[model samples]
Target: MSRFLFISCLCTLLLACQHSPKKNYFYLSPISEKTVTQTSSNVSSQLIGIGPVDIAEYLTSSQIIDNQSDNTLTMSDNAYWAEPLDKSIARVVSLNLTQLNNGRSFVNFPWRSDSKPHYSLRLHVDTLSRTGKNANINATWELIDNDAKKSILRRNFLRSIPAESGAKGLAYAYSQLLAELSKEMDEALNQNP
Candidate 1:
Protein backbone atom coordinates (compact mmCIF):
# COMPACT_ATOMS: atom_id res chain seq x y z
CA MET A 1 0.00 0.00 0.00
CA SER A 2 2.86 2.45 0.82
CA ARG A 3 4.64 1.77 -2.49
CA PHE A 4 1.43 2.29 -4.50
CA LEU A 5 0.65 5.55 -2.71
CA PHE A 6 4.15 6.98 -3.39
CA ILE A 7 3.94 6.16 -7.11
CA SER A 8 0.51 7.75 -7.38
CA CYS A 9 1.70 10.94 -5.68
CA LEU A 10 4.73 11.21 -7.95
CA CYS A 11 2.60 10.74 -11.05
CA THR A 12 0.16 13.44 -9.93
CA LEU A 13 2.98 15.93 -9.39
CA LEU A 14 4.46 15.23 -12.80
CA LEU A 15 1.10 15.70 -14.50
CA ALA A 16 0.54 19.01 -12.68
CA CYS A 17 3.88 20.37 -13.83
CA GLN A 18 3.09 19.43 -17.41
CA HIS A 19 0.18 21.87 -17.29
CA SER A 20 2.41 24.77 -16.19
CA PRO A 21 3.20 27.57 -18.62
CA LYS A 22 6.41 27.59 -20.62
CA LYS A 23 9.30 29.66 -19.36
CA ASN A 24 9.93 33.04 -21.01
CA TYR A 25 13.29 34.58 -21.85
CA PHE A 26 14.31 38.22 -22.06
CA TYR A 27 17.23 40.13 -23.52
CA LEU A 28 18.50 43.68 -22.86
CA SER A 29 18.56 46.15 -25.73
CA PRO A 30 19.92 49.68 -25.92
CA ILE A 31 18.43 52.08 -28.47
CA SER A 32 19.57 51.17 -31.96
CA GLU A 33 22.48 49.39 -33.54
CA LYS A 34 25.90 51.04 -33.72
CA THR A 35 29.40 50.21 -34.79
CA VAL A 36 32.78 51.53 -33.65
CA THR A 37 34.33 53.47 -36.46
CA GLN A 38 37.18 55.75 -37.46
CA THR A 39 36.91 59.52 -37.40
CA SER A 40 36.38 61.03 -40.83
CA SER A 41 36.56 64.67 -39.78
CA ASN A 42 39.15 66.86 -38.11
CA VAL A 43 37.83 66.55 -34.57
CA SER A 44 39.82 66.49 -31.37
CA SER A 45 38.62 63.17 -30.02
CA GLN A 46 40.05 60.86 -27.41
CA LEU A 47 40.37 57.13 -27.81
CA ILE A 48 37.93 55.84 -25.22
CA GLY A 49 38.09 52.30 -23.97
CA ILE A 50 35.15 50.89 -22.03
CA GLY A 51 35.25 47.75 -20.06
CA PRO A 52 35.09 45.63 -16.92
CA VAL A 53 31.48 46.26 -15.93
CA ASP A 54 31.36 44.83 -12.43
CA ILE A 55 27.78 43.97 -11.46
CA ALA A 56 26.37 42.85 -8.16
CA GLU A 57 26.95 39.17 -7.50
CA TYR A 58 23.32 38.53 -6.73
CA LEU A 59 22.16 40.02 -10.01
CA THR A 60 24.71 38.11 -12.03
CA SER A 61 22.19 35.41 -12.85
CA SER A 62 20.33 34.16 -15.88
CA GLN A 63 17.03 34.99 -14.21
CA ILE A 64 15.71 38.53 -13.94
CA ILE A 65 15.68 39.85 -10.40
CA ASP A 66 12.76 41.50 -8.68
CA ASN A 67 13.49 43.39 -5.49
CA GLN A 68 10.75 42.37 -3.10
CA SER A 69 12.08 44.60 -0.35
CA ASP A 70 15.20 46.33 0.87
CA ASN A 71 16.91 43.07 1.66
CA THR A 72 14.92 40.49 -0.22
CA LEU A 73 14.83 39.47 -3.88
CA THR A 74 12.75 37.13 -6.01
CA MET A 75 14.01 35.41 -9.14
CA SER A 76 11.54 34.31 -11.79
CA ASP A 77 12.41 30.92 -13.04
CA ASN A 78 9.96 31.28 -15.91
CA ALA A 79 11.33 34.69 -16.93
CA TYR A 80 15.08 34.96 -17.48
CA TRP A 81 17.77 36.77 -19.37
CA ALA A 82 18.56 35.43 -22.83
CA GLU A 83 22.25 36.05 -22.15
CA PRO A 84 24.39 37.05 -19.22
CA LEU A 85 23.26 40.41 -17.87
CA ASP A 86 26.76 41.83 -17.43
CA LYS A 87 27.87 41.21 -21.01
CA SER A 88 24.65 42.63 -22.41
CA ILE A 89 25.00 45.76 -20.31
CA ALA A 90 28.58 46.28 -21.41
CA ARG A 91 27.64 45.84 -25.04
CA VAL A 92 24.71 48.23 -24.74
CA VAL A 93 26.79 50.89 -22.97
CA SER A 94 29.61 50.74 -25.51
CA LEU A 95 27.17 50.78 -28.40
CA ASN A 96 25.28 53.74 -26.99
CA LEU A 97 28.44 55.77 -26.47
CA THR A 98 29.70 54.94 -29.91
CA GLN A 99 26.43 55.97 -31.50
CA LEU A 100 25.92 59.02 -29.31
CA ASN A 101 29.06 60.61 -30.75
CA ASN A 102 30.25 58.78 -33.82
CA GLY A 103 32.89 61.41 -34.43
CA ARG A 104 34.84 59.99 -31.50
CA SER A 105 36.70 56.71 -31.40
CA PHE A 106 35.24 54.07 -29.10
CA VAL A 107 36.71 50.66 -28.49
CA ASN A 108 35.82 47.79 -26.25
CA PHE A 109 38.42 46.67 -23.77
CA PRO A 110 40.98 43.96 -24.64
CA TRP A 111 42.03 45.94 -27.67
CA ARG A 112 45.41 45.50 -29.27
CA SER A 113 48.30 45.33 -26.83
CA ASP A 114 49.94 48.44 -28.26
CA SER A 115 46.78 50.50 -28.29
CA LYS A 116 47.08 53.46 -25.97
CA PRO A 117 43.76 55.06 -25.17
CA HIS A 118 43.75 58.67 -24.08
CA TYR A 119 40.92 57.87 -21.69
CA SER A 120 39.31 54.78 -20.24
CA LEU A 121 35.89 54.32 -18.68
CA ARG A 122 35.17 51.76 -15.99
CA LEU A 123 31.77 51.08 -14.47
CA HIS A 124 30.55 49.52 -11.25
CA VAL A 125 26.82 48.83 -11.32
CA ASP A 126 25.45 48.43 -7.84
CA THR A 127 21.71 48.25 -8.45
CA LEU A 128 20.28 46.89 -11.66
CA SER A 129 17.04 45.55 -10.42
CA ARG A 130 13.35 45.94 -11.09
CA THR A 131 10.33 46.39 -8.89
CA GLY A 132 8.12 45.03 -11.70
CA LYS A 133 6.45 48.43 -12.00
CA ASN A 134 9.70 50.34 -12.42
CA ALA A 135 13.32 49.63 -13.19
CA ASN A 136 16.31 51.33 -11.55
CA ILE A 137 20.06 51.41 -11.94
CA ASN A 138 22.42 52.91 -9.40
CA ALA A 139 26.04 52.96 -10.42
CA THR A 140 29.36 54.74 -10.13
CA TRP A 141 31.67 55.25 -13.06
CA GLU A 142 35.25 56.50 -13.31
CA LEU A 143 36.97 58.04 -16.28
CA ILE A 144 40.75 57.83 -16.12
CA ASP A 145 43.05 59.72 -18.43
CA ASN A 146 46.05 57.52 -18.98
CA ASP A 147 48.15 60.24 -20.55
CA ALA A 148 47.79 62.47 -17.50
CA LYS A 149 47.71 59.54 -15.10
CA LYS A 150 44.73 61.09 -13.30
CA SER A 151 41.03 60.58 -12.95
CA ILE A 152 38.96 63.10 -14.85
CA LEU A 153 35.45 62.07 -13.87
CA ARG A 154 33.98 59.98 -11.11
CA ARG A 155 30.24 60.24 -10.85
CA ASN A 156 27.45 58.29 -9.23
CA PHE A 157 24.11 58.14 -10.96
CA LEU A 158 20.70 56.86 -9.93
CA ARG A 159 17.79 56.84 -12.32
CA SER A 160 14.34 55.31 -12.36
CA ILE A 161 12.68 53.78 -15.41
CA PRO A 162 8.93 53.54 -15.61
CA ALA A 163 8.31 50.10 -16.96
CA GLU A 164 5.62 47.50 -17.39
CA SER A 165 5.04 43.94 -18.64
CA GLY A 166 7.92 42.65 -16.59
CA ALA A 167 11.17 41.83 -18.39
CA LYS A 168 10.62 44.06 -21.42
CA GLY A 169 10.08 46.99 -19.17
CA LEU A 170 13.24 46.26 -17.26
CA ALA A 171 15.19 46.02 -20.50
CA TYR A 172 13.89 49.39 -21.60
CA ALA A 173 14.85 50.89 -18.30
CA TYR A 174 18.35 49.47 -18.59
CA SER A 175 18.71 50.94 -22.07
CA GLN A 176 17.69 54.36 -20.85
CA LEU A 177 20.34 54.15 -18.17
CA LEU A 178 22.95 53.53 -20.84
CA ALA A 179 21.67 56.43 -22.91
CA GLU A 180 21.86 58.80 -19.98
CA LEU A 181 25.29 57.60 -18.97
CA SER A 182 26.67 57.94 -22.50
CA LYS A 183 25.41 61.49 -22.82
CA GLU A 184 26.94 62.50 -19.53
CA MET A 185 30.22 60.74 -20.22
CA ASP A 186 30.46 62.36 -23.64
CA GLU A 187 29.83 65.78 -22.15
CA ALA A 188 32.37 65.22 -19.40
CA LEU A 189 34.99 64.12 -21.89
CA ASN A 190 34.33 67.22 -23.93
CA GLN A 191 34.78 69.43 -20.91
CA ASN A 192 38.05 67.76 -19.90
CA PRO A 193 39.50 67.64 -23.39
Candidate 2:
Protein backbone atom coordinates (compact mmCIF):
# COMPACT_ATOMS: atom_id res chain seq x y z
CA MET A 1 0.00 0.00 0.00
CA SER A 2 2.81 2.46 0.91
CA ARG A 3 4.65 1.82 -2.37
CA PHE A 4 1.48 2.43 -4.40
CA LEU A 5 0.73 5.68 -2.51
CA PHE A 6 4.32 6.96 -3.12
CA ILE A 7 4.04 6.29 -6.85
CA SER A 8 0.69 8.07 -7.06
CA CYS A 9 2.08 11.20 -5.31
CA LEU A 10 5.07 11.26 -7.61
CA CYS A 11 2.82 11.07 -10.63
CA THR A 12 0.71 13.93 -9.32
CA LEU A 13 3.79 16.05 -8.73
CA LEU A 14 5.08 15.41 -12.19
CA LEU A 15 1.77 16.34 -13.76
CA ALA A 16 1.60 19.54 -11.74
CA CYS A 17 5.08 20.51 -12.85
CA GLN A 18 4.13 19.98 -16.46
CA HIS A 19 1.19 22.37 -16.35
CA SER A 20 2.10 25.76 -17.85
CA PRO A 21 0.98 29.02 -16.38
CA LYS A 22 -1.54 31.20 -18.16
CA LYS A 23 -0.13 33.77 -20.56
CA ASN A 24 -0.71 37.50 -20.08
CA TYR A 25 -2.01 39.29 -23.14
CA PHE A 26 -1.77 43.04 -23.76
CA TYR A 27 -2.78 45.58 -26.41
CA LEU A 28 -1.73 49.09 -27.30
CA SER A 29 -4.13 51.76 -26.04
CA PRO A 30 -5.05 55.11 -27.60
CA ILE A 31 -4.18 58.47 -26.18
CA SER A 32 -6.48 60.00 -23.64
CA GLU A 33 -8.64 62.99 -24.62
CA LYS A 34 -6.93 65.15 -22.06
CA THR A 35 -3.65 64.83 -23.90
CA VAL A 36 -5.12 65.73 -27.27
CA THR A 37 -4.74 69.29 -28.54
CA GLN A 38 -7.70 70.77 -30.30
CA THR A 39 -7.16 71.80 -33.91
CA SER A 40 -9.13 73.98 -36.31
CA SER A 41 -12.26 72.43 -37.75
CA ASN A 42 -11.60 73.44 -41.36
CA VAL A 43 -10.07 70.04 -42.19
CA SER A 44 -12.90 68.15 -40.56
CA SER A 45 -14.45 67.21 -43.90
CA GLN A 46 -11.28 65.57 -45.22
CA LEU A 47 -11.29 61.79 -45.07
CA ILE A 48 -7.88 60.46 -44.15
CA GLY A 49 -6.75 56.86 -44.26
CA ILE A 50 -4.03 55.39 -42.12
CA GLY A 51 -2.43 52.41 -43.59
CA PRO A 52 0.48 50.50 -45.03
CA VAL A 53 2.02 50.70 -41.58
CA ASP A 54 4.95 48.31 -41.54
CA ILE A 55 7.02 47.18 -38.62
CA ALA A 56 10.42 45.62 -38.16
CA GLU A 57 10.65 41.88 -38.84
CA TYR A 58 11.48 41.16 -35.24
CA LEU A 59 8.32 42.88 -34.07
CA THR A 60 6.07 40.69 -36.20
CA SER A 61 5.90 38.06 -33.45
CA SER A 62 3.23 38.05 -30.79
CA GLN A 63 5.85 37.94 -28.08
CA ILE A 64 6.86 41.23 -26.50
CA ILE A 65 10.54 42.03 -26.78
CA ASP A 66 12.72 43.77 -24.25
CA ASN A 67 16.25 44.90 -24.94
CA GLN A 68 18.40 44.17 -21.93
CA SER A 69 21.35 45.96 -23.48
CA ASP A 70 22.57 47.29 -26.79
CA ASN A 71 23.35 43.75 -27.89
CA THR A 72 20.86 41.59 -25.97
CA LEU A 73 17.13 41.26 -26.67
CA THR A 74 14.75 39.11 -24.67
CA MET A 75 11.41 37.97 -26.04
CA SER A 76 8.88 37.39 -23.29
CA ASP A 77 7.67 33.82 -23.12
CA ASN A 78 4.63 34.39 -20.90
CA ALA A 79 3.42 37.71 -22.32
CA TYR A 80 1.71 38.03 -25.68
CA TRP A 81 -0.02 40.62 -27.83
CA ALA A 82 -3.77 40.42 -28.06
CA GLU A 83 -3.60 41.19 -31.79
CA PRO A 84 -1.01 41.79 -34.50
CA LEU A 85 1.29 44.63 -33.45
CA ASP A 86 1.17 46.40 -36.82
CA LYS A 87 -2.63 46.37 -36.97
CA SER A 88 -2.88 47.53 -33.40
CA ILE A 89 -0.55 50.41 -34.15
CA ALA A 90 -2.58 51.47 -37.17
CA ARG A 91 -5.81 51.32 -35.19
CA VAL A 92 -4.39 53.29 -32.30
CA VAL A 93 -2.95 55.91 -34.63
CA SER A 94 -6.27 56.29 -36.41
CA LEU A 95 -8.05 56.79 -33.13
CA ASN A 96 -5.47 59.29 -31.98
CA LEU A 97 -5.72 61.28 -35.21
CA THR A 98 -9.48 61.47 -34.90
CA GLN A 99 -9.19 62.86 -31.41
CA LEU A 100 -6.47 65.34 -32.26
CA ASN A 101 -8.13 66.68 -35.37
CA ASN A 102 -11.53 66.92 -33.68
CA GLY A 103 -14.04 66.19 -36.49
CA ARG A 104 -11.64 64.61 -38.98
CA SER A 105 -12.60 61.17 -40.33
CA PHE A 106 -9.93 58.50 -40.25
CA VAL A 107 -9.95 54.88 -41.31
CA ASN A 108 -7.49 52.02 -41.13
CA PHE A 109 -6.22 50.28 -44.20
CA PRO A 110 -8.32 48.01 -46.43
CA TRP A 111 -11.06 50.43 -47.31
CA ARG A 112 -13.09 49.82 -50.45
CA SER A 113 -12.00 51.55 -53.62
CA ASP A 114 -15.25 53.49 -53.95
CA SER A 115 -14.69 55.09 -50.54
CA LYS A 116 -11.06 55.93 -51.00
CA PRO A 117 -9.69 58.65 -48.72
CA HIS A 118 -8.37 61.99 -49.88
CA TYR A 119 -5.06 61.53 -48.15
CA SER A 120 -3.17 58.41 -47.09
CA LEU A 121 -0.58 58.18 -44.37
CA ARG A 122 2.07 55.50 -44.72
CA LEU A 123 4.41 54.53 -41.91
CA HIS A 124 7.43 52.29 -41.60
CA VAL A 125 8.66 51.48 -38.15
CA ASP A 126 12.36 50.78 -37.99
CA THR A 127 12.54 50.01 -34.30
CA LEU A 128 10.07 49.69 -31.46
CA SER A 129 11.60 48.04 -28.43
CA ARG A 130 12.05 48.55 -24.72
CA THR A 131 15.69 49.03 -23.88
CA GLY A 132 16.78 49.21 -20.26
CA LYS A 133 14.46 51.81 -18.66
CA ASN A 134 13.06 53.34 -21.81
CA ALA A 135 10.88 52.43 -24.74
CA ASN A 136 12.20 53.65 -28.10
CA ILE A 137 10.55 54.13 -31.48
CA ASN A 138 12.15 55.08 -34.80
CA ALA A 139 9.95 55.51 -37.82
CA THR A 140 9.62 57.19 -41.21
CA TRP A 141 6.28 58.36 -42.50
CA GLU A 142 4.85 59.96 -45.64
CA LEU A 143 1.59 61.66 -46.48
CA ILE A 144 0.39 61.24 -50.02
CA ASP A 145 -2.25 63.15 -51.92
CA ASN A 146 -4.39 60.49 -53.50
CA ASP A 147 -6.01 62.83 -56.01
CA ALA A 148 -2.68 63.87 -57.54
CA LYS A 149 -0.95 60.54 -56.84
CA LYS A 150 2.01 62.36 -55.33
CA SER A 151 3.77 62.51 -52.00
CA ILE A 152 3.44 65.84 -50.22
CA LEU A 153 5.11 65.38 -46.86
CA ARG A 154 7.70 62.99 -45.51
CA ARG A 155 9.45 62.88 -42.15
CA ASN A 156 11.36 60.67 -39.77
CA PHE A 157 10.79 60.47 -36.05
CA LEU A 158 12.85 58.96 -33.24
CA ARG A 159 11.67 58.99 -29.68
CA SER A 160 12.52 57.37 -26.37
CA ILE A 161 10.15 57.54 -23.45
CA PRO A 162 10.78 56.46 -19.89
CA ALA A 163 9.10 53.15 -19.14
CA GLU A 164 8.19 51.15 -16.09
CA SER A 165 9.66 47.78 -15.23
CA GLY A 166 7.15 45.39 -16.83
CA ALA A 167 5.42 44.63 -20.09
CA LYS A 168 2.53 46.95 -19.25
CA GLY A 169 4.93 49.85 -18.92
CA LEU A 170 6.51 49.04 -22.23
CA ALA A 171 3.11 48.96 -23.92
CA TYR A 172 2.16 52.31 -22.41
CA ALA A 173 5.41 53.87 -23.57
CA TYR A 174 4.77 52.68 -27.09
CA SER A 175 1.27 54.13 -26.98
CA GLN A 176 2.61 57.50 -25.89
CA LEU A 177 5.11 57.43 -28.69
CA LEU A 178 2.34 56.85 -31.20
CA ALA A 179 0.33 59.71 -29.76
CA GLU A 180 3.29 62.06 -30.19
CA LEU A 181 3.71 60.86 -33.73
CA SER A 182 0.07 61.54 -34.44
CA LYS A 183 0.49 65.08 -33.23
CA GLU A 184 3.43 65.56 -35.53
CA MET A 185 1.46 64.15 -38.45
CA ASP A 186 -1.48 66.37 -37.69
CA GLU A 187 0.82 69.36 -37.73
CA ALA A 188 2.23 68.32 -41.05
CA LEU A 189 -1.23 68.01 -42.55
CA ASN A 190 -2.21 71.43 -41.29
CA GLN A 191 0.94 72.90 -42.75
CA ASN A 192 0.45 71.31 -46.15
CA PRO A 193 -3.28 71.82 -46.40
List all candidate RMSDs to the true structure.
Answer: 4.1, 3.2
TM-score of each: 0.78, 0.88
- Looking at candidate 1, what is the lDDT of residue 191? 69
- Counting only residues 3 or more apart in sequence or on different chains, how many pairs clash (N, Cα, C under 3 Å) in candidate 2? 0
Q: Among these predicted structures, which one has the highest TM-score?
A: 2
- Least lDDT summed over 10 consecutive residues: which range in candidate 2? 35-44
Q: Which residue runs does candidate 1 get wrong by more than 4 Å?
A: 1-21, 32-46
Q: Write the residue-wise lDDT of candidate 2 on 112-188 in tens digits.
A: 89889989999999999888888999999999888899899889999998999788888889999999998899888
Task: Summarize candidate 1's per-residue lDDT along 18-49 as a digit string, tens digits.
Answer: 99988898877655644333233246454788
lDDT of each: 0.76, 0.88
Residue pairs in clash, model 2: none
TM-score, cand. 1:
0.78
